[model samples]
Target: MSISATEGVGPSLWGLGATTSAKTQQDKDMFLQLLVAQLRYQDPMNPTDSSQFLAQSAQFTSLEKMEEVAAQTAAMVQAQLAFGASSLVGTTVTYATGPAGDDGSPAPTATGVVDGVTFGSQGPVLSIDGTDVALAALHTVTRPGIGPDAGTAAATPADD
Candidate 1:
Protein backbone atom coordinates (compact mmCIF):
# COMPACT_ATOMS: atom_id res chain seq x y z
CA MET A 1 0.00 0.00 0.00
CA SER A 2 1.28 3.46 -0.94
CA ILE A 3 0.64 6.29 1.53
CA SER A 4 0.12 9.78 0.18
CA ALA A 5 0.77 13.23 1.66
CA THR A 6 -2.99 13.64 2.41
CA GLU A 7 -3.13 10.40 4.40
CA GLY A 8 -2.41 12.09 7.78
CA VAL A 9 1.22 11.01 7.76
CA GLY A 10 3.43 12.87 10.23
CA PRO A 11 3.41 16.02 8.05
CA SER A 12 -0.16 15.50 6.87
CA LEU A 13 -1.32 16.24 10.41
CA TRP A 14 -0.79 19.87 9.47
CA GLY A 15 -2.27 19.58 5.99
CA LEU A 16 -1.15 22.06 3.29
CA GLY A 17 -2.18 24.70 5.86
CA ALA A 18 -3.02 27.23 3.15
CA THR A 19 -6.68 27.87 2.45
CA THR A 20 -9.03 30.79 1.90
CA SER A 21 -11.46 29.25 4.40
CA ALA A 22 -8.90 29.54 7.20
CA LYS A 23 -9.04 33.31 7.67
CA THR A 24 -8.53 33.60 11.44
CA GLN A 25 -5.25 33.94 13.33
CA GLN A 26 -5.84 30.50 14.90
CA ASP A 27 -5.55 29.02 11.42
CA LYS A 28 -2.17 30.67 10.97
CA ASP A 29 -1.00 29.23 14.32
CA MET A 30 -2.11 25.79 13.22
CA PHE A 31 -0.20 26.14 9.98
CA LEU A 32 2.92 27.17 11.86
CA GLN A 33 2.52 24.20 14.17
CA LEU A 34 2.35 21.92 11.13
CA LEU A 35 5.53 23.43 9.71
CA VAL A 36 7.39 22.93 12.99
CA ALA A 37 6.19 19.35 13.26
CA GLN A 38 7.31 18.64 9.71
CA LEU A 39 10.77 19.98 10.50
CA ARG A 40 11.04 18.02 13.76
CA TYR A 41 9.99 14.69 12.24
CA GLN A 42 12.00 15.01 9.02
CA ASP A 43 14.14 11.96 8.22
CA PRO A 44 17.58 12.24 9.82
CA MET A 45 19.23 10.79 6.66
CA ASN A 46 17.68 13.60 4.57
CA PRO A 47 17.06 16.52 6.92
CA THR A 48 14.99 19.46 5.75
CA ASP A 49 17.02 22.42 4.48
CA SER A 50 17.31 25.38 6.88
CA SER A 51 16.99 27.69 3.90
CA GLN A 52 13.63 26.18 2.97
CA PHE A 53 12.31 26.82 6.46
CA LEU A 54 13.59 30.39 6.34
CA ALA A 55 11.91 30.93 2.95
CA GLN A 56 8.56 29.66 4.21
CA SER A 57 8.75 31.88 7.28
CA ALA A 58 9.58 34.87 5.09
CA GLN A 59 6.67 34.10 2.79
CA PHE A 60 4.21 33.99 5.71
CA THR A 61 5.56 37.27 7.04
CA SER A 62 5.18 38.88 3.64
CA LEU A 63 1.62 37.66 3.34
CA GLU A 64 0.75 39.16 6.73
CA LYS A 65 2.34 42.48 5.82
CA MET A 66 0.51 42.58 2.51
CA GLU A 67 -2.83 41.96 4.25
CA GLU A 68 -2.12 44.78 6.68
CA VAL A 69 -1.28 47.16 3.85
CA ALA A 70 -4.48 46.25 2.05
CA ALA A 71 -6.53 46.92 5.19
CA GLN A 72 -4.87 50.31 5.65
CA THR A 73 -5.53 51.22 2.06
CA ALA A 74 -9.22 50.33 2.43
CA ALA A 75 -9.51 52.46 5.58
CA MET A 76 -7.90 55.43 3.83
CA VAL A 77 -10.31 55.16 0.94
CA GLN A 78 -13.32 55.00 3.28
CA ALA A 79 -12.10 58.09 5.12
CA GLN A 80 -11.74 59.97 1.86
CA LEU A 81 -15.22 58.99 0.80
CA ALA A 82 -16.69 60.14 4.10
CA PHE A 83 -14.92 63.50 3.80
CA GLY A 84 -16.07 64.03 0.23
CA ALA A 85 -19.64 63.08 1.08
CA SER A 86 -19.79 65.41 4.06
CA SER A 87 -18.83 68.31 1.85
CA LEU A 88 -21.96 67.65 -0.19
CA VAL A 89 -24.16 68.67 2.72
CA GLY A 90 -26.15 71.88 1.94
CA THR A 91 -25.20 71.47 -1.73
CA THR A 92 -27.54 70.67 -4.61
CA VAL A 93 -27.15 67.37 -6.40
CA THR A 94 -28.93 65.78 -9.36
CA TYR A 95 -29.04 62.00 -9.06
CA ALA A 96 -30.58 59.12 -10.94
CA THR A 97 -33.57 57.43 -9.37
CA GLY A 98 -34.52 53.73 -9.58
CA PRO A 99 -32.87 51.16 -11.83
CA ALA A 100 -31.81 52.23 -15.28
CA GLY A 101 -33.25 49.76 -17.74
CA ASP A 102 -31.76 48.85 -21.13
CA ASP A 103 -34.34 50.85 -23.09
CA GLY A 104 -31.88 53.73 -23.65
CA SER A 105 -34.46 56.11 -22.19
CA PRO A 106 -33.30 59.20 -20.32
CA ALA A 107 -32.95 58.37 -16.65
CA PRO A 108 -35.22 60.29 -14.34
CA THR A 109 -33.31 62.74 -12.16
CA ALA A 110 -34.17 64.37 -8.83
CA THR A 111 -32.51 67.43 -7.29
CA GLY A 112 -32.23 68.02 -3.58
CA VAL A 113 -29.97 69.19 -0.79
CA VAL A 114 -27.62 66.55 0.61
CA ASP A 115 -29.11 66.09 4.07
CA GLY A 116 -26.29 63.89 5.33
CA VAL A 117 -23.73 61.27 4.41
CA THR A 118 -23.83 57.67 5.50
CA PHE A 119 -21.73 54.60 4.86
CA GLY A 120 -23.24 51.44 3.44
CA SER A 121 -21.69 48.03 3.03
CA GLN A 122 -20.50 48.89 -0.47
CA GLY A 123 -19.55 52.57 0.06
CA PRO A 124 -20.96 56.05 0.70
CA VAL A 125 -24.70 56.69 0.49
CA LEU A 126 -26.18 60.20 0.49
CA SER A 127 -29.40 61.35 2.12
CA ILE A 128 -31.28 63.31 -0.54
CA ASP A 129 -34.85 64.46 0.19
CA GLY A 130 -35.25 61.67 2.80
CA THR A 131 -33.96 59.08 0.35
CA ASP A 132 -30.78 57.11 0.46
CA VAL A 133 -28.92 57.58 -2.81
CA ALA A 134 -25.63 55.92 -3.55
CA LEU A 135 -22.70 58.19 -4.34
CA ALA A 136 -22.48 56.44 -7.68
CA ALA A 137 -26.06 57.52 -8.46
CA LEU A 138 -25.11 61.19 -8.52
CA HIS A 139 -25.30 62.89 -11.91
CA THR A 140 -24.19 66.38 -10.83
CA VAL A 141 -23.20 68.33 -7.74
CA THR A 142 -23.39 72.15 -7.69
CA ARG A 143 -22.80 74.76 -5.03
CA PRO A 144 -26.00 76.35 -3.65
CA GLY A 145 -25.22 79.79 -5.10
CA ILE A 146 -23.74 78.73 -8.44
CA GLY A 147 -26.84 77.09 -9.92
CA PRO A 148 -29.91 78.89 -11.27
CA ASP A 149 -31.97 77.09 -8.60
CA ALA A 150 -30.47 77.03 -5.15
CA GLY A 151 -30.41 73.82 -3.14
CA THR A 152 -33.38 73.24 -0.83
CA ALA A 153 -32.53 73.48 2.84
CA ALA A 154 -32.18 70.15 4.60
CA ALA A 155 -35.33 69.50 6.64
CA THR A 156 -33.55 67.83 9.54
CA PRO A 157 -30.41 66.03 10.61
CA ALA A 158 -30.09 62.51 9.28
CA ASP A 159 -30.99 59.55 11.48
CA ASP A 160 -28.12 57.45 12.75
Candidate 2:
Protein backbone atom coordinates (compact mmCIF):
# COMPACT_ATOMS: atom_id res chain seq x y z
CA MET A 1 0.00 0.00 0.00
CA SER A 2 1.18 3.52 -0.81
CA ILE A 3 2.03 5.56 2.27
CA SER A 4 0.23 8.90 2.37
CA ALA A 5 2.13 12.13 3.03
CA THR A 6 -0.50 13.25 5.54
CA GLU A 7 -0.04 9.91 7.35
CA GLY A 8 3.56 11.07 8.07
CA VAL A 9 5.47 8.97 5.50
CA GLY A 10 5.72 9.20 1.75
CA PRO A 11 7.45 5.88 0.89
CA SER A 12 9.63 3.30 2.58
CA LEU A 13 10.62 -0.34 2.44
CA TRP A 14 7.69 -2.46 3.77
CA GLY A 15 5.86 0.88 3.48
CA LEU A 16 6.12 1.33 7.25
CA GLY A 17 7.79 3.68 9.70
CA ALA A 18 10.36 2.42 12.23
CA THR A 19 8.33 4.02 15.02
CA THR A 20 6.75 1.92 17.78
CA SER A 21 3.27 3.28 17.14
CA ALA A 22 2.22 -0.23 16.10
CA LYS A 23 0.29 -2.43 18.48
CA THR A 24 1.89 -5.21 20.55
CA GLN A 25 0.17 -7.96 18.57
CA GLN A 26 1.43 -6.46 15.36
CA ASP A 27 5.00 -6.58 16.72
CA LYS A 28 4.49 -10.22 17.69
CA ASP A 29 3.20 -11.01 14.21
CA MET A 30 6.20 -9.36 12.58
CA PHE A 31 8.61 -11.20 14.86
CA LEU A 32 7.11 -14.59 14.01
CA GLN A 33 7.03 -13.88 10.30
CA LEU A 34 10.66 -12.78 10.34
CA LEU A 35 11.71 -15.82 12.37
CA VAL A 36 10.00 -18.17 9.94
CA ALA A 37 11.48 -16.44 6.91
CA GLN A 38 14.95 -16.59 8.43
CA LEU A 39 14.59 -20.28 9.20
CA ARG A 40 13.47 -21.07 5.64
CA TYR A 41 16.43 -19.21 4.13
CA GLN A 42 19.23 -19.92 6.64
CA ASP A 43 22.44 -21.60 5.43
CA PRO A 44 22.68 -25.20 6.64
CA MET A 45 26.39 -24.74 7.52
CA ASN A 46 25.56 -21.71 9.68
CA PRO A 47 22.20 -22.73 11.08
CA THR A 48 20.72 -20.78 14.01
CA ASP A 49 21.77 -22.01 17.45
CA SER A 50 19.00 -24.13 18.96
CA SER A 51 19.82 -23.18 22.57
CA GLN A 52 19.91 -19.44 21.79
CA PHE A 53 16.58 -19.63 19.96
CA LEU A 54 15.02 -21.48 22.92
CA ALA A 55 16.41 -18.87 25.33
CA GLN A 56 14.97 -15.99 23.31
CA SER A 57 11.59 -17.75 23.11
CA ALA A 58 11.71 -18.25 26.87
CA GLN A 59 12.50 -14.57 27.35
CA PHE A 60 9.44 -13.58 25.31
CA THR A 61 7.24 -15.87 27.44
CA SER A 62 8.73 -14.42 30.61
CA LEU A 63 8.05 -10.90 29.36
CA GLU A 64 4.39 -11.77 28.81
CA LYS A 65 4.08 -13.32 32.27
CA MET A 66 5.74 -10.34 33.94
CA GLU A 67 3.48 -7.92 32.12
CA GLU A 68 0.44 -9.89 33.29
CA VAL A 69 1.72 -9.87 36.86
CA ALA A 70 2.32 -6.13 36.75
CA ALA A 71 -1.21 -5.53 35.52
CA GLN A 72 -2.62 -7.72 38.30
CA THR A 73 -0.54 -5.89 40.87
CA ALA A 74 -1.83 -2.53 39.64
CA ALA A 75 -5.42 -3.74 39.85
CA MET A 76 -4.89 -5.11 43.33
CA VAL A 77 -3.37 -1.87 44.55
CA GLN A 78 -6.23 0.15 43.09
CA ALA A 79 -8.80 -2.13 44.74
CA GLN A 80 -7.02 -1.92 48.05
CA LEU A 81 -6.84 1.84 47.88
CA ALA A 82 -10.50 2.09 46.92
CA PHE A 83 -11.50 -0.14 49.83
CA GLY A 84 -9.37 1.85 52.24
CA ALA A 85 -10.70 5.15 50.95
CA SER A 86 -14.32 4.02 51.15
CA SER A 87 -13.89 2.64 54.67
CA LEU A 88 -12.72 6.05 55.87
CA VAL A 89 -16.14 7.57 55.25
CA GLY A 90 -17.44 7.12 58.82
CA THR A 91 -14.53 8.10 61.04
CA THR A 92 -13.14 11.45 62.12
CA VAL A 93 -9.78 11.83 60.43
CA THR A 94 -7.51 14.77 59.61
CA TYR A 95 -4.29 14.15 57.74
CA ALA A 96 -1.46 15.59 55.65
CA THR A 97 -0.10 14.08 52.40
CA GLY A 98 2.35 16.60 51.06
CA PRO A 99 2.81 19.90 49.27
CA ALA A 100 1.22 19.62 45.85
CA GLY A 101 4.41 19.02 43.91
CA ASP A 102 5.34 20.29 40.46
CA ASP A 103 3.55 17.35 38.85
CA GLY A 104 0.11 18.24 40.22
CA SER A 105 0.17 16.85 43.72
CA PRO A 106 -3.01 18.14 45.43
CA ALA A 107 -2.92 21.18 47.71
CA PRO A 108 -3.19 19.23 50.98
CA THR A 109 -6.94 18.80 51.33
CA ALA A 110 -8.08 17.48 54.72
CA THR A 111 -11.65 16.50 55.41
CA GLY A 112 -13.47 14.50 58.10
CA VAL A 113 -12.80 10.82 57.71
CA VAL A 114 -16.46 9.92 57.72
CA ASP A 115 -17.80 12.22 55.06
CA GLY A 116 -20.04 11.95 52.01
CA VAL A 117 -18.41 10.89 48.77
CA THR A 118 -19.51 12.91 45.78
CA PHE A 119 -21.48 10.64 43.43
CA GLY A 120 -19.68 9.88 40.12
CA SER A 121 -16.93 12.30 40.99
CA GLN A 122 -13.23 11.76 40.29
CA GLY A 123 -10.11 11.76 42.51
CA PRO A 124 -9.48 11.19 46.21
CA VAL A 125 -10.52 13.98 48.58
CA LEU A 126 -10.56 12.56 52.11
CA SER A 127 -7.82 11.77 54.56
CA ILE A 128 -7.90 9.08 57.27
CA ASP A 129 -4.46 9.49 58.79
CA GLY A 130 -1.08 11.08 58.33
CA THR A 131 0.03 10.12 54.79
CA ASP A 132 -2.72 7.49 54.66
CA VAL A 133 -4.50 9.73 52.22
CA ALA A 134 -7.13 9.67 49.54
CA LEU A 135 -5.81 7.21 46.95
CA ALA A 136 -6.53 9.42 43.98
CA ALA A 137 -4.32 12.18 45.35
CA LEU A 138 -1.48 9.74 45.69
CA HIS A 139 0.99 8.69 43.06
CA THR A 140 1.26 5.39 44.88
CA VAL A 141 -1.31 3.64 47.10
CA THR A 142 0.56 1.28 49.33
CA ARG A 143 -0.73 -2.02 50.65
CA PRO A 144 -3.68 -1.20 52.93
CA GLY A 145 -2.00 0.87 55.57
CA ILE A 146 -1.66 -0.10 59.24
CA GLY A 147 -2.31 2.94 61.39
CA PRO A 148 -2.07 3.62 65.14
CA ASP A 149 -3.36 0.90 67.47
CA ALA A 150 -6.43 2.29 69.19
CA GLY A 151 -6.56 -0.87 71.26
CA THR A 152 -8.20 -1.04 74.69
CA ALA A 153 -8.25 2.78 74.71
CA ALA A 154 -10.29 4.40 71.93
CA ALA A 155 -10.27 2.99 68.35
CA THR A 156 -8.43 0.55 66.11
CA PRO A 157 -7.36 1.77 62.68
CA ALA A 158 -7.69 0.28 59.17
CA ASP A 159 -6.42 -3.20 59.88
CA ASP A 160 -9.42 -4.63 58.11
Backbone clashes in each candidate structure, one number apiece?
0, 1
Error of 1 at 55 (Å): 0.8
Score every model by TM-score: 0.70, 0.50
Candidate whose TM-score is highest: 1
After superposing candidate 2, which stretches have Cα over 4 Å from the reference?
1-22, 95-110, 116-160
lDDT of 2 by residue, 53-147 (tens): 78877876676566567767976876666666676566665444467669886667554444444322354455343334444543422222434
Taken over the whole model, the C-alpha lDDT of each candidate is 0.78, 0.54
Supply the global lDDT for candidate 1: 0.78
